[model samples]
Structures are given as structure tokens and as C-alpha cells.
Target: MNKETVEVIDRELLTDRDYVSPGLEIIKPDKCFPNMIVEDTSASDWPYLRREIPHNWYVDQRNNYVGFLSRDEANIVYNTALKFRGKRALEIGCWYGWSACHIALAGVELDVIDPLLAKEDIYESVTNSLQCAGVMDLVNLVIGYSPQKVEELAQQLQRKWSFFFIDGSHDAPSPLNDAIICEQLAQTDALILFHDLNSPDVAQGLDYLKQKGWNTMIYQTMQIMGVAWRGNIEPVQHQPDPKVNWNLPEHLPNYSVSNLSADLVKEFLEIVTAIRPYTLLGEARLFSLYSLAKKVCIEDIPGNFVECGSYKGGAAALLAFVIKRYSLRPRLLYACDTFAGMPDPSEVDIYNGIPANLTGFGVGALKAPIAENIKSICKLLNVEDIVVPVKGLFAETLPQYKSEIGNIALLHADGDWYESTMDIFNTLYDSVVPNGLIQVDDYGYWDGCKKALHDFERLRGEQFNLHRIDYTAVWFKKGNFLPN
Candidate 1:
């Protein structure tokens, strides 16, 4: 770990003690500014921060400016600037200069561009905040919109920027455009940070950088923040607050199994609970697989149930159980996998164009035990006779058993990579009976899985009317649903 000392100004000197805003308090700085030591740790590991905002700078602004930056976010901006002190920096949007104040205070030569800064009130407020912070000389306030104004500044200054803070429009194409334009004016080892990554639009901008080979990490701030940079320098990591609800809600309003009997729901819960040790699927996803499998069996859909990527056969056990409990006709559940581990991911298997291996989807990942373990799971579920463990890669086993696997009722696709997912669809899609169900487990989580589904749809010249099973899963009925 490397340590650097940063000089901090007493916050009491920066804010007017008499200034007050409605529904807000103007509190004095708790302590005097001291030279603080910040640890510069290895980029690969999460950085340990003794204090988030060592300076504890606070500004009392009007209600409109209050929500722009939380205390923690303000500290992040200040510390980031401190790390890159003496380097040129650009900020795309500065509502009332809250963040700009922090950046300038860290000794960075800052340029702030925003159309709102053209308005008299906003411009005055920004300048006032900067002047009060004692860093007015560090900032060059530009009154114009980005991309256009950013391009003009790039040409005029003819200087490569080392740090960027993009908090522009949260709309699609706008964020993406800002990133592309700023990238051109950035140094080879520049660090570009973006705010509002919770918005899918803002995330697209970061995705563009990741595709361009920049190292990236997302900070779980209130609105979420993302950082992208080239070369060896790693940005300091922010630990997420435990009090915040970080994970997406599993039970969405759209998820409904009202049609299912209370008894059936109870039975599913029992079965899934029993097999929970063998699967990585959450409760929502497990129920989705169970309900869909039960649907095909109850409706007497012609064909057997097929599961690709049956990791540990937990889900396959559920499929066989549904056939045993619901299907009036005899149907087999074909559980397929290598019984070894995942094959090597192709180039197309990536997360927003970042290589799969870098994101934890590498060769031999998500490996299941040998085929005997799957058989043991089936025997424990009392579906041993109905569940058949087919041990091999999908590319080989799928075609080899295509004859015996004639006419599928439901195809549960859990293969996470591009090639694995595509191989299952290519070989088994034709065997599915009309209106049969195809459930995809990683549609939202893996770019490669989504691409395979899309490419297959285009090849068949038919767009599927996909139904959301959860945040990461979706299913569509074959030959019955189409895009509007």
C-alpha cells in the first residue's frame, strides 16, 4: 500500500455559519483541517479507507442543491480529485457546483460545462459556491451544453484531460454521446467517472468504455456510480452501505402464480427446499421453473422435458417431479451436461463486451459432479425412473440423442455462455412441439446468452414474446407468441 498526504482546509472557513435553507441545517465543521494520510492500495484489491471524507467539508445550500451530492458522494469527488491533483479535469454537468467545489478544492485544474450554468441564478450560485470554497481560481466555468461545447473546448484548449466526472443527461444516447466525445479529449491513462449508473441509459455509456478495453468498476452510491480507465492505475473503491437495499427485489409485482393451487404451491416449496443445496437458483427462479414445467405437464403438451446445463440436477429433479405429479401421460426428463465443467467461452461470450473470463465466466466454471451425483439426486427425489442423466457437452450429446429426445414439451436453458446456449437451441429448438415453452436462465445477466437468443430469433425470422420470470430469467412459448 502507498500512502499520500492531502492538505485539508477547515470547513468552517468555507461555509457561512449564518446561512440557512428551509428543511436543512447549517452545521459547523466538527474539527480543524489537518494533513490526512490516504492509503493508495493495489488496484486488484478493494481499498481500505480509514475515513471516507477526512476533511468533512459541508456546504449549506438551498433545497434545490441539497440532493445533488450526499456527504459520502461529495467526499468521493474530493478524494478522486486529490488523487489526480495537478492534472486537468472536466465535469460535464454542475447543477449548483456542489461536486465542482469538491473537485476544485483538491487542487485539480477543473473545467465545468453545463447549459444550466448559462442561467443567471444557476451561474451565480455556482460561482458563489466556488468562491466560498476558496477554490474559485481552480475552476473555468463554461456556459454551454456538452458534446458541442465539449468539442469546442477540446479544440480550444488542445490539452488531454486526466480526470472526468460525467453527470450529464440521464437519457439514452446523450450519456453515450458525452462519453464518446470526452474519450477523444482524454489522456491515454485518463480516469473517467460517471454518475447515475442506476439508469440503464447511463450504464450504456460505461458499457461503451468497457467495450473499448477500459478497466471498470461500479460504486454502489445512491444513484450508483461507474468508473473507467486505461493503464495500471486503479481508482479507490467505495464500500457499499449495509443499510441500503442493494439487491433488486425478488418478488416483483408482475410475478403471479394465482392460478396455481395452494396445495401445488406448498408442494413446490417443499421440493425446492429439499433440493436447495444442489442449485444456485433463488426462490423466485426456482418457482418459475417449477410452475412452467408443471404447466406443460398439466396441459398434456406433447413431448418430453429437456434441461440443458443441469448443474447438479437440482432443477432437473424439479422437472421430473412435475411429470410424476402432474403429467397424465408418460414423459421423460432429459437432463444434459458434461458432468465435468463448462467448456471454454468463445469471444462472443462477454458481459457488455468485456471478456467472459475477466468477469468470472471461465473454462471449467460452474462445474457439476459426475453423472452418478445427478442419478443420486433423482433417486432421492423418487424420480429416478423418469429422469435420465445425459453426460456430455451439449454439442455432442444433444445431436446424439436428438432421435430419442423427439418432440420437447419444454426446454429449460441454463447454459450461461454463448456457445453452450446456442448449441442447445440449435439442436433442440426444432424438436419442441408447437407452443412449447423455452425458459432462459441468464437472459438478463449474461450478454452472450441474450445474443444467442436474439441471433436465433433472427435466423428463424421470428421475434419471441418473452415473459419475465425474474430480473435475470425469461421464457417464451414457441410458435404461439410474437413481437407486436
Candidate 2:
């Protein structure tokens, strides 16, 4: 027990007052800065966490409740829970119940604590919000402060949290108390999420936790939200092992007439023949390939999911849908892209002709709002917990992430340009486990993307082989690529 805990046990009321401040006067808001309420727009543009805040919603010094949780934040919570389905969870300071709702929707049982909700009116609103989102039944709400109420509930329920979120009070002692109690209740593989870690009060709490051996990963920007996972700290040794349906040929489309539903076959042929304005594969092929890749991987490999070059997140969106439909285990999916647009062509050694897609950056050919639309679909489908969006180019960002694909069964490379394609292939290829499959989007379509693939093969001599598909090519690595 620490000083505060000791003080509490010694019959003295430990002051939550220390968590509050008054003497220092800061500039008061003339008009509400509603932006503060939603997931701070300035928050790192990691696609999974990037969410839009309403203009009217602002953070009030006293009782701030304007901007609702951004769609992205809500989606993050949803997907995390989905990935940890059947795992126990605790969420401290669940305001408005958006994160809690996402957790429940992801099929995880939850115990949510919010002392502020002891007020009946707030309780009613919380219930209303959860009900509105159709997740009221998933939560076991504990209405009181931590240690006291949380401890009592833990004693009664005898539940241990595998995942915890500290989003309640962004103050010192309050969050510190939340962290202390959470530490006592977390399981070995537990993950703790802290909101507003950049704030002075919360930073103190985060600092204290870090001192106690918690590994913190900071997602900093407007308002820092730090995630600390409590577990055996070991260097991750990921080996990607993407697989194919040994029976499924690489070059052949999965859209064979025999396997398709009558309706689907008709729609596909119509689209392929250009009888319809859209090609199902042209319009939805990217995502469908993503879906197909994830399905093939999950069915064969034993690891999490990831996709590079996620324009409109179509591929990732398909991955989430498949994970949900199959009741797959370990439901997390990561999607990486330059949400603003593609990287500068000049910077890319290959793919010079690739037009800019949306952001006036890359080869401007792909649509801009597709990724946003994928997010919207994620919310609607209630699979937010299964998908995580990393916003940025593959070269600038993905190389840093510690992947869990020690058994990567499938990899989808859709950069469609040589530089981007080769970058991802070079960076992530070795991570693929044995017998893994790497699917390239523009293997046959783009000159640069194709050239990069061939060059990589020629330079390496025996890294992978081309499985010529009808419209695209699938490369299966017999062995891993040594990093340059």
C-alpha cells in the first residue's frame, strides 16, 4: 500500500481535493472550444484513433460534455474489445458510455466505474446513452469512486480485468487512485488505456505507473492518450506465415461460377463486362481481396491481421466483416495508409507515373473519401473492435510497429507503385511466417509496381515466385527476405 492507501486505511479521508486546482487562474473560454470534447482532432493521425469532433462540442472547465467521442476513438475501443473477445475488462470513468458501448459490442463483458455517475441524473444519462447505442445490457456499471466501489464490486464479482481504460478524472490523485486500484485488479496480460495523459494531472498518474514497471506507448498529439500494457516484457519475434488455400490457385479469381451464388455471379459478370457502371472487382475488389486475404490467412495462419495501402480502408473493412462472421479468435486488424493522400512521387524511386489519388500527393487516381466511408461502415457493422487504422504512408510509419505476425498467413500489398510496394515488401516481408502469401494489388496493372516486384525478385534471386492470377499476380515467398 502507498501513502494514500495507508492514509485511507488509517481513518483519515484522503483528499480528492488535491486532484482539483483553484489558485492558478488560466484564461477563461469566451466561447466554448468544443473541439476539446471530442477525441482531440490534433491527436496523432493514426487512422485507428483519428476521429472527427463536432464543432459545437467543447471542453468546459467545470463540467465539460459537448463533443461526443469521435467515431475513430469509439471504433478503437470497439475493435480492442472484439479482438479480446471473452476477456474480462474494466473501464474507469466511462463518460457518456461511448467506449463502454464499443467494448460490449465487441463481445467482451465489462465492469465500468464512474464516480461522477453517482449522481442520479448522470446515471440516467449514462443509461440513456448506452441504451441509445443498444449496448446498455453489456455493461455492469458501478456507480461510485475507485478502490471503494470498484474494490467492493471486484470482491463481489470476483472478476479480473484483462483490459482497463483510465478515462475518468484527468487529475492527479484521482487518476493515480484509478491506476493504483487498477494495478491491483489487472491480469497478467492486461492492457491499460489512459486518456489525456498529456494533461498535468494525468501525466503525474502516468509517470507514477511508469515508475511501477508499466510499459507505456504514447499516442501523443492534441491530447495525449497513453496505452500501457502490463505483461512479461519480451522482444517480439514475429515471423509472417501467410497461407493460401493450397487448393485455391493464385492467379484464378475466387469468383469462379461454381463457387458463387447465382445472384453474386450475375452481379460479378455484369460488373466485369462493364454492363453495369461499376466493376464489382473494380469498385469492391480491393476490399474483397483484403477480405479474401484475411480469410485465407486466419483460416491458415495463427496471428493477428494487417493491411498496407488502405485507401478508403476497403480491404480492412472486408477483414473486419470476415472476422466477425467467422467468430475468429484474436480479432484485431490493422490498416495502414496515408489518410491525407499518397506520398510525393518524386520521393519514390519507382511508381513515378502513379497519379495522386486524393490528397494531391500520390498518383491521383484512387478516391479520397473511401477510407472515411470504411470507418462509417465499421461503426454501422459494429465491428469497430476488430479493425485498427494507422494513418500515414507505409514508408514513414509501419516499419516502427512491433507486429504480431510470427505466423503471418497472408499479406496484402496494394501500394500500386514501385517505391511504396517495394518499401512495404522489404520492411514487412521477413515478418511473414513460412508458407505465407503476399498479394499485390497492381502486380500486373501498374508498370512501376510490377517492375519493383520483379526487381526485388531478381535482386534477391529466390525470395518469391509469381502465381499469375487472371487480372493480378500473387507472390508466395518460399523463404524470408534478408533486410537490406
Candidate 3:
């Protein structure tokens, strides 16, 4: 852990145009910001929010503000800490004091800690938000880096921390450091809330706590943003169920999408409907593609984008849309697949009940290859140049381009057969860069795919915490990008 002062970013890293993480499909707010209670606004614009908070203040704190965290998350924080009244609470990064104010509103006297709070350029807005929220009395400003502040609080506080909110340096180690500190400072029954569930760092921190038997539960008001807690208050058994499906949106759009711009997704969906007609993909998995792609691009993770199974090219098309919309051109999106439908299955796949027709049907032989359609669709979408199609079985073609397809950021394996899935897994799993996302589209529904994932985990000797968005698709994050 970096025990020195928090190294605050000199300027904002994200912009309004930057699709907020976990954003896919956009929902019109029934009531706009400051009033939106339970609705999700993960990958969305902030005009409403801009109007709510003063523009100058928003500009100053926009970089650090968890603008995606709306009222539902605030309520959860307030309620979680409310029970631990009179307890010492910690807000690791008090950006604009939105979350810190909410932490204080929970009725606990919370310490608002942030390295930027020490800057004159930031202190006024941070304090004003708390003051306006009527939480200044309940809040104590601690201007220091997150990791070092934990040590300071550990020595100053009389009792253990009952409520801990970690929303600071998103680097993997920071959350882990905060978690370790919380373990030392927490009462027997404590509640810890972590932001940025999409972030590999926060996710890893939660995993560390879970291994130690913390009652950790992740909640996605819009997208996996708030990870809530229930400590030793109850004697529930430690259930090692790592994969939980984020709640399905109550209404399904005509075409489900990701956290790309609503306008961009709409146009892309129209083109996808024309080309794909039937996208077995769901909203959750689709959104994962957008969020994952955006993170790799935004964080500038060293890798190219690859999709092992681009059937009719719905997913590859969505990726193209995001790449074009975000102006991430020059970075190629390699869409590899057999022009023919499915390649023959191996014994393992056959034993797992994969039929020849679904697993090994040729394009011209009753089942036609859709590579041309994918190309045509991409052409119409003005993203054909970016979609480099390799028309052959994954086993046959992936090996030839092993050198060409260097590091990968998002690997979506949709080949349902065990032979096909594992072939891609063995071939490309190593190429996924740190903080990249590998999403399997058939794990939940296909026994062969599930077996392949299990066998791979066993071979690696490390169990990856798989997260499900639906019955058929599952995703797990890779290594943290935080520097050691």
C-alpha cells in the first residue's frame, strides 16, 4: 500500500461525453437528479445533474465526483450507517462531499478523508456541499491520503469503526489497503460500502474481505456501484456463492444494449436488428461489453479488442459502435469465427450433450456462414474497416494469428461447445490485459461451456469470482491495473 499522501489527479480524467461505467440502456428519469430515488442512470449524461449542482462547483469536482451514484445508493449508505449510531465512520475519498454528506446523514459522526480536500481549489466546494446538506456538524474533515489516513484514524479513534465507505483512489491497492485497515479498525459488527463495482480494484478488495468471512453483498442501483455490508449482526453461514446476477431491468427495450450513448446505441441497435434479427444476447451481458470496452480504452490498457464468437455480429457491431462513438479508431476490433455455423465438437463437448447440428454445422451445408452478413452490417454501420473478420474455426484460425492478436482487453467467448470454448480460452485467456474482462456467453445455459470454465479454473488453481447478468452469460474481471 502507498502509505504516503494520496496522489490526486491534476485534472479531471472523465468528461460528460464519457459514458459513465455500467451504462448501456438509458432510462428517462421519472424525477430528475436530487429527486431520483431508485432509478438507475449508470452510463448517462449529466445535464440534469449539472443543473442541480452549481456548474462552477461541478466543474471543480467533476473529476472526483461519483456522479453515477444516485439516491438509491445514498439511501443504502445512510441506512447502513444509521444503525451504528455514535460510531466512528470513515469516507475514504470525500469528492464534493456528496457521499461523505450521505455517510454523515446516516447519523454517525463520520470522518471525511481525501487528499484533494487539502487543496484550496477543492476545499470550498467539498465543505459547501457538506454544509448545504446540513452534515458539516456530523462530518470531520481529514485532509490526507486514504492509506495514511487509515493509520491516523486508527490511532485517534477510541473505538472501532462501525461504518466504512471506501470511494477513494480507484487503483486496486488503495481499496485493498482501505479494506485491510477496516479489518483492523472495524468493530465485530461493521458495515463497509465500496464504490465502482465495475472497477477491478474495488471488486478485488471485496473478494479479500469475503475470503475472511465478511458478509459482503453487491447492489447495482444502476450498474454495480454500491457494495453493501452486514457484519456479525447475524450468524449467517459463509456461503461461497460468488456469482450473482445483477437485477434485470424491469422493462426490456425493443433491443437491449450497453452503457454507450443512448443515441449511439439506438442507431447501432437499429443496424443490429437489420443484420442479426435475433440477438441471443441480453441487456446485462451487452452492457458488460460496453463497460468493459470503455474501461480498457479509457484506462488505455495495452491490448487489442477481440471477440471469439461473432455469430451474426451483434456484439462485434456494438463494440464497433462504441469504438466509433468514442472515436477510438486505429484500434482494430478482431471478429474471429467460422464462416460456417458451428465446428464439430470434441468428445467432451459431445458428452456434455452438444449436438452436431448446433456444434458443427457448415454454412453452405444447410447452415450458412454469416461472416459476409457481419461484414455487410459493419459496412452499413460505417465500422467495417474496424471489424477484421477471420473466417475459420477458432481452433484452426486463432493459432495462426497468435502473434498478430497481441494483448486483449475484452474477450467475449460465445462458442457454446466445450471444445470450442476451451480452445479459445486456452488460446486467448493469457492475452487479456490487467483489468480486462473475459465474458462467456454460454456458461449459464450450456453445460459444455460451464464445464470448460470449471476445468480452466481448476487448471489455473485459482477460482475466479464469476458474475452473472443472465442465465446464459457470465463475466469475471482479470488482474488489477494498480501499480504495486
Who wins the lDDT comparison? Answer: 1
Q: Give per-residue CA lDDT, model 1, range 133-170, as digits (tens).
A: 66788899998988899999988988679899998776
Summarize candidate 3's per-residue lDDT along 1-484 as a digit string, tens digits.
0101111111123233222222121212111123222222323353223222211122222343335344334434544554454567888887666566655654577887889888875688667655655557778888898778778867876646777888887776888888888777887667677765556666667777776766655553333443434543311111111232333323211212222344544554454455444344644466567666766666666677889888767678778766766644357788887757666655554322544345433223323356456766777678887888887888888988878988887788888778888889898988887777888887755567888988987887657756544335667778622122
Ranking by lDDT: 1, 3, 2
Instruction: Name every residue pair that clashes in candidate 3.
Output: 23-43, 23-259, 24-258, 24-259, 363-367, 363-368, 363-369
User: Candidate 3: how large is its RMSD?
Assistant: 17.9
Each candidate structure's TM-score, on Cα atoms with residue i matched to residue i, is: 0.49, 0.41, 0.45
Single out the weakest 10-residue window by summed lDDT for candidate 1.
17-26
Candidate 2 residue lDDT tens string, 271-372: 223211111123223324533554564565555566777766545655565566663466566777776655555423332244434323345445445444
Off by over 4 Å in 1: 1-260
Clashes of 3: 7
Question: In model 3, where do residues sit more than 4 Å from their true spots?
Answer: 1-278, 327-329, 346-372, 480-484
RMSD, candidate 2, Å: 23.3
CA lDDT, every prediction?
Answer: 0.71, 0.53, 0.60
Backbone N/Cα/C clashes per model? 0, 38, 7
